[model samples]
Target: MPKIFSLFFLFVLLISCDEDVLPKPKAYLSLEYPKKSYKKLPLKRPYTFNVLKNTTIIDDKNNWLKIKYPTLKASIDITYRPIQNNMKELLTEAEKLVFKHAVKAEQIIPKDFVNTKNRVFGSLYEITGNAASQLQFHVTDSTHHFIKGSLYFYAKPNYDSILPAVAYIKSDILHLIETLEWKKSI
Candidate 1:
């Protein structure tokens, strides 16, 4: 009788231990994203702006595309060719735009230019409002056969809010510049 009671107690202890040994609840880690969708708008000019096909616009007229990583809180603006048409003129126009908005603007040196697989690119810093953000632009006149590209994140005035998205979206910008197709002038 004593031996039987001891065995039953041991069996109960083993069952309790087994119940406690459940597989650690599956650990899951993921980023949170907003519900988003994009539509192709009719190109009003000869230029075409192609987004990731997954972006969403809070408004079409404002040209705001909800960024994929909301933590970055970013949007892309694809402005068509303004009056300035050539690369030189475009650069000058861009400089003017930056200076107009920035309390201070500085042109980066050649050492700052980063050589990627295809194009040479540099960043210009502009301090506007109370914060400073980067104005990074890359040009590939050789491939596109014409001067064409974009000024990005112009609406983002906060450096902290804009920098992360700028960094994340830069690869996409490089891809866009790499795969650019120029409309041949008839």
Candidate 2:
């Protein structure tokens, strides 16, 4: 009976000596995506740009493209529109599409891009916060071709959780813009 009592006392002492229970500080996920490699997506589209090596093309019809990154649960949607007599309207709609996210976005940043030699001038938007899309861009020759691309993740829109992927994919987008040239421009 003495031995049993001693064992009980020892167990109680050990359990009670634990450190105070404090809540853990918040930590975002650490996602490491592969370094980007430029590969002309094997599509007969009018423009060609270096994209990530592992990007899987989902659709390449009528100049519309869907690049999928299943591992990252993200996709880039490319929409091509012929500039009818309405470049103004197209720009308005693209800007509207991006601004619509302002309801859920902390802020929307616009960065202008121009490549006069290639005649590829455009604007890229980085929508911060819990928006459905983290990045979007609209590029055109102002007379013939207009393309809008947006990046969306399949998972919930938590920018903090998927920031690593956003930064990595953003580099690829910049590469594409830098290297983009319309067949007509050629």
Candidate 3:
């Protein structure tokens, strides 16, 4: 009986060994984002810009706004400042906010935007890796209006997982910057 059992075990082992063990390839989620449609935000702040029609705008006091993407679990926090001869200081503050995530960011790539016709000038900072904020930007008219915006996710910072959403929103941000206009008063 023991010999028969050993033969059965050996037969099973030989059968299993016929196929080489192979590692399964890693998989990622296949995300499908909606086709974008944009319109001007209906708020009477010091500034105006186009936002994704799918987003919900939450207007806070003092010209601060939260552009929420509930489906995507993200939001762009916007803070508006009236430049009172403090352009240098404001630029420093915006850079500080971007670099604060440097400890967690693998890289920070900055792209500058200058639209002299629209009187808009700014820099967009893209933060790679597991940083808290994936994107940050600051735009100004150099004399009267300045705004700083940051992109944040509601979940834990996993750069790889959130990259698609980041990309989608980044285009929306670019549109906003392109359409950005400042008013003399709100």
Candidate 4:
């Protein structure tokens, strides 16, 4: 009886002396984006602008285009609408297109852009949160050309998971806006 009691005590002491177990540390996804080199898009339209070297421009109908990043599964859909005394209506439709994401967006930030030399003016919307589109913009000469652009991920919308891609593509959009020049002839 005394030997059994001593054996149990020794086993308990040895087990208790071992280090405590801990849960594994949480891991996060790390995404690396490439550096962007901007070059002017070769197109004959009322306006022209630069695009990221990483993108492939799929020829769309009329003056419209889709700037696609296949590796990232994302694309910027661009639509060109002629402004024939209907700038107000066109602008309203652009606004509505962005505001429609308000239900899922945490916030919609509008950055107004204007370049007198290029005669390009527009509002860029940065939609934060798990929205379908992370960015949208509309550029126009206020008389002749209207360009509406929106960025969409091919995958399901998850802001945190796709943020790196969004940030990388957003810079390209800004470059496009900055370099936009109205040729005023199709």
Give all TM-scores, in the order shown: 0.43, 0.83, 0.86, 0.84
**Candidate 3, 83: how far from true, in Å?**
0.5
- Estimate, for each residue in 86-150, the C-alpha lDDT of model 3 and write its tens digit: 99999999999999999999999999999999899999999999999999999999999999999
Q: Write the per-residue lDDT of candidate 1 for residues 48-100, one digit (tens) a residue.
A: 33444455433334222232333454454444342334666666765565555
Per-candidate clashes come to 0, 0, 0, 0
Among these predicted structures, which one has the highest TM-score? 3
**Residue 65 lDDT, candidate 2, scale 0-100:** 93
Tens digits of per-residue lDDT for model 4, 1-186: 999999999999999989977999999777777777877897676778898887899988878999999899999999999988999999999999999999999999999998988888999999999999999999998878999999999988999888888888888899899999888456
RMSD in angstroms between candidate 3 and the native structure over all alpha carbons: 3.2
Off by over 4 Å in 2: 1-29
Task: Give me the displacement of residue 44 in model 1, in angstroms.
Answer: 7.5
Per-candidate alpha-carbon RMSD to the true structure: 10.0, 4.9, 3.2, 2.9
When summed lDDT is taken over every stretch of 10 residues in candidate 2, the lowest stretch is 28-37
Ranking by TM-score: 3, 4, 2, 1
Q: State, as a TM-score between 0 and 1, how close model 3 is to the true structure.
A: 0.86
Identify the superior model by TM-score, candidate 1 or candidate 3. 3
What's the residue-level lDDT of 4 in candidate 4? 100
Expressed as tens digits, the lDDT of each residue in 1-186 for candidate 2 is 999999999999999989887899998666667766778867777777777888898766678998888899899999988898989999999999999999999999999998999999999999999999999999998889999999999988998888888988888888888988888642
Q: Report the alpha-carbon TM-score of model 1 versus the true structure.
A: 0.43
Choose 1 or 2, whichever is better by lDDT: 2
lDDT of 1 at 57: 38
Query: Which wins on TM-score, candidate 1 or candidate 4?
Result: 4
> Which residue pairs clash within candidate 4?
none
